[model samples]
Target: MKTASIAHRVVDFLRRWPPFQYFDDDELFSLVSAGRVVFHERDELVFMQGRQRKPYVYVIQQGAVRLEEQSEDGVDQLRDVRGEGDLLGIGRYLGFGEHVYTARTETDVILYALPAEAFWETVKRHARASRFLATYFSVAILPPALEMREERSEELRLGRRPVDWMSRPVEQPSRPLTCLPDTAARDVARLLAERDAAAAVVIDGQGAPRGVVTPRTLSDEVASGRQPPDTPAQALMRPVCAVAAPGLEAGDYLTRMLDQQTEHLVLTANGRLDGPFAGVITRRDLTRVEGAAPLALIEDMARAPRISELAALRVQAEGVLAAGLTDPDATRWLAPMAGAFNAAVLRRVVMLVEGALADQGLASPNLDHCWVFFGSAARNELFTRHDLDCGLIYDDPDPGHARGARAYFLELGRRVSAALAACGFVTSAKAISAGHPSACRSVGEWEVAFADWIHQPIESCVYRATSRFDLRPVHGDCRLVERLERHIHGEEDRNPRFVPLLLEDSMANLPPLTFFRGLVVDDEGGYREVLDLLRATLQPVVDIARALALDSGRQAPTTLDRLLVLQPEDDESSLLIEETAAAFRNALYHRARTGLTTGTDGSRVDPAKLTRLEQNLLKSGFRTVLRLMEYTGRRYGLTPRR
Candidate 1:
């Protein structure tokens, strides 16, 4: 059978649609030919309820296909409609028995009928296509994305959420075994054996968690044989470090643990640690949150009505992520959450902004404009910061062609920028706003400008590349966005001038801390009276990771995730690299929390507020980040250019 010009258009349209977007042109045409086109009169049954549909899928070509449902509860409802190129009979092709919804032609219609064997054969060969059909077949599967979400929710309710990857308070520690500060090692050792326990909590006179003495700790001390066997248990005990309110997420658990610098967390009913130790949360608990975070957020995004609601919801999703950044396992959990939410938000932004722009005369003749997100968003790195880096690409650069489109793009950016601002992040002050001429350009102009940036590799050019690496289409033609990326990779993937210079810029991260001595802060110095958020942590890790990734042709959107993909396995160095990054995130979270608590933007951590154990952990983690930054600089030969 010969495919029509209309069939080719169907192919083109299907290729643009998702799941189908994953298929190539040749394969698409074959799919069109295997499918038969039929016309239906008004109010006729396209496929009856309980009908056995074996060899066809339908796409509403010229009119609409309405699916009416007769519920078991004795109510009739219009389930959904398939209009225009919307694919239908997916359940018929994919479902096993009787159809759940009855399909009827709403108006005079031309519908394409795809052969079941051919469609299934094509889908079976492609996993995304299989999932694509499976996903859209019903509203149910689309909600949580998987069964794992309910399990995660249950875990969160049980206080075993993502933060627990850093720690899990004992499900039930046997009846309290406490020892006085002055208890002997011999007595403590004997008591441990008698109680059939490896450790015992050491409390002050007031019965507060002062420290803990474990067999490993005790044995290590005993190995020295310096202290008498009768030495006080407190003498060998590690001081209490991180403490949190009971029933927190695993991510929070890991973060607080990382911040306080201890694996053992003292849990309290309230924030105050005056009560008995509720339990301990070890780093083993973060794993559950990873599988759960992405699913939970996706479900929540589906339920959320307004963008404002989603903004807060997105913020809530970060609770575990903040914690995951502390423990080694936490980042793993954070990665998928970051990627999924980032993708979800980008998708929703396109829908919302497109609707808003349509109201403002965008696409008056089916718009040729594309709204793109660059920098972190494009590359799948979504931080809480307002990274308002975006651009608009239209089909023509002949100023007159985009006059209405330009105004639409400006209004589009303003609305999106405002939406993002209301959602927590502060927008950019400079004209990176889509309304600005510098950011919004016609497709030809954008291409020319991009080419110039790639070739020049100047200071301004460096900034552009650094900021624009993550350019993704939030709205309009994503093919246009992909083309832009291909052009970038082809031109600047390993450009010596650009890569080397990026390395140099990244090298100017936090100053290496003294190994023997600690970092010093001068009275009026940048680090003075505050934890240098930029220098004390995140900047060094992010900047160096980005540089290393770019230099190595990894071409990632962000620092941490790129590093993970680049070196998925853990060795001495990669472990150090990962842990160092976690430390940076830990510091940032701590600063943010501190700032939030004190109602001050300055992330001031009072050394006195932290227990000795926490101070030590913070010091060790901070030092690790500093060392990693220096190591990357040395490894990459990032010498200061004269």
Candidate 2:
């Protein structure tokens, strides 16, 4: 064939798929000219598992290929089937030198093999084309990407040379000197000197961090004779510079300090400044880590000057999470750390939204308000596939001002929500976000809303409460959230019908188990015959923990923490609690591992992928979920509704 004719045929095929479709005609033709056609017979091996990869990527022009993995018993199990337009040899393109899965032609096939170098050159030249390919790669070829990552994790775990910028285990430094906001500055200084600390955290009555007093502030206030030593610490301290959460690496604190240009960062138990104070990280801690920190991405997101920069920083945050998945302890920390990063992103989005609203000549909301997060984000159990479930709660607006104030907050919600989506948070399908008017309400409105839901106790109301009751303040004035929390706990305590309805709702989804079939799979959903680990396993535990915690007048955010705080009524219950806790941990570990490996929320598991021990542990976990449901039923004098 003539060179031009051959290139024309290749371009014709390339234009039919994404990424190439994003390229201009001239770019497409140029991209195709560097490629050549290759042919494979039916059943011929295109690439072998464990073989070093070639420096070329293949796009099928005709026919199909099967990706398979060989088991220890020497049996080939089909992993995926790819047809025309599907890219192959991506393992090599992604820098995984050895093919993890063997690709074999399912029929006589024609493929265009493009050199990796040329493809990357094109990707570099076309920004939109690169984005198109990235979206395609994340959605379609993520499994292989995950496999490559897991291989790197294994290398690290085996004590191979460490990746640059090693993450040191997060430590809880000795408790910093603390005082009430009303404490005299002289007393604060004495305590700081007595504790041998450079700063003191000034907290409110509830132990929520309000501000910080550093040596410089002390010197400026007292030593300069600008104010009497009797001045309250609240008047002298600066707003808390930044808050670090547990499990954050030393590098994370360092990055926060560098980004804020502050010498000190407070450590909070759950990453919320309003949560319990744990410790502090100072400038001295930065010396422990020798390279650029991944947490720098979060800092970058916070300081991002534009929406585009914020969006790009989020991608970097995801990369950080992906890299951290290799370390087991780091993996444990990934969800919470991701939550902290997300909170910072959301705050930036809010600031931008407020600024945009101001530019539009819209008046700011005329009430104190808060941004509340629900579901996994609220519980600090966020993972890759989680979406935004948030709402707005403002102080009661004057009746005459209600309409305008509501409209302003609603628009703010919509703008911030859209920004969050751009930053990689999936929008909730249920419309249970700040963007929804029903979810954006005043504090009094929320109180009345909870009361109405409790009094009604309808199925839908209970269902909504199951998620809503897990709310936590993510940004804005958190006092509104504290008020909302007080209202929920009070309603739970006063209403006799609320706990039973909640119990019934929690028990509605029973864990799957059948003696003959073993672990039951969801047959009706997209995950047909695959175990719905999130629904059947983790959620039941989560639901039961929420119910029990509420019943005990406690509001622990996470399932594990809630389970730990429960006071079992009997030895049997205690044993179940301990066993159930262990099982829950196992299930969580498995989900995290699977999600990290597959680049999705690890909510589903194929039994075949689990070893015998893991399978047994999962079975036990489900059984414990079932038992907890029954216990709730009996404790509440409730019967399963037909």
For 476-502, candidate 2 gives per-residue lDDT tens digits of: 788999988888888878887777777
Candidate 1 Cα lDDT to native: 0.58
- lDDT for 472 in candidate 2 is 78
Model 1 stretches with alpha carbons more than 4 Å out = 1-160, 163-331, 335-339, 342-346, 360-400, 428-432, 459-461, 472-476, 512-527, 555-557, 565-585, 588-615, 621-636, 640-642
TM-score of 2: 0.60
Q: What's the C-alpha lDDT at position 390 in model 1?
A: 67
| TM-score of each model, paired residue for residue | 0.47, 0.60
Mind giving the per-residue lDDT tens digits that candidate 1 earns over 430-451? 3255656777776667767766
What Cα-based lDDT does every candidate model obtain? 0.58, 0.70
Q: After superposition on all CA atoms, what RMSD does each candidate show versus the true structure?
A: 28.6, 15.4
Clashing residue pairs, candidate 2?
A: none
* Strongest candidate by lDDT: 2
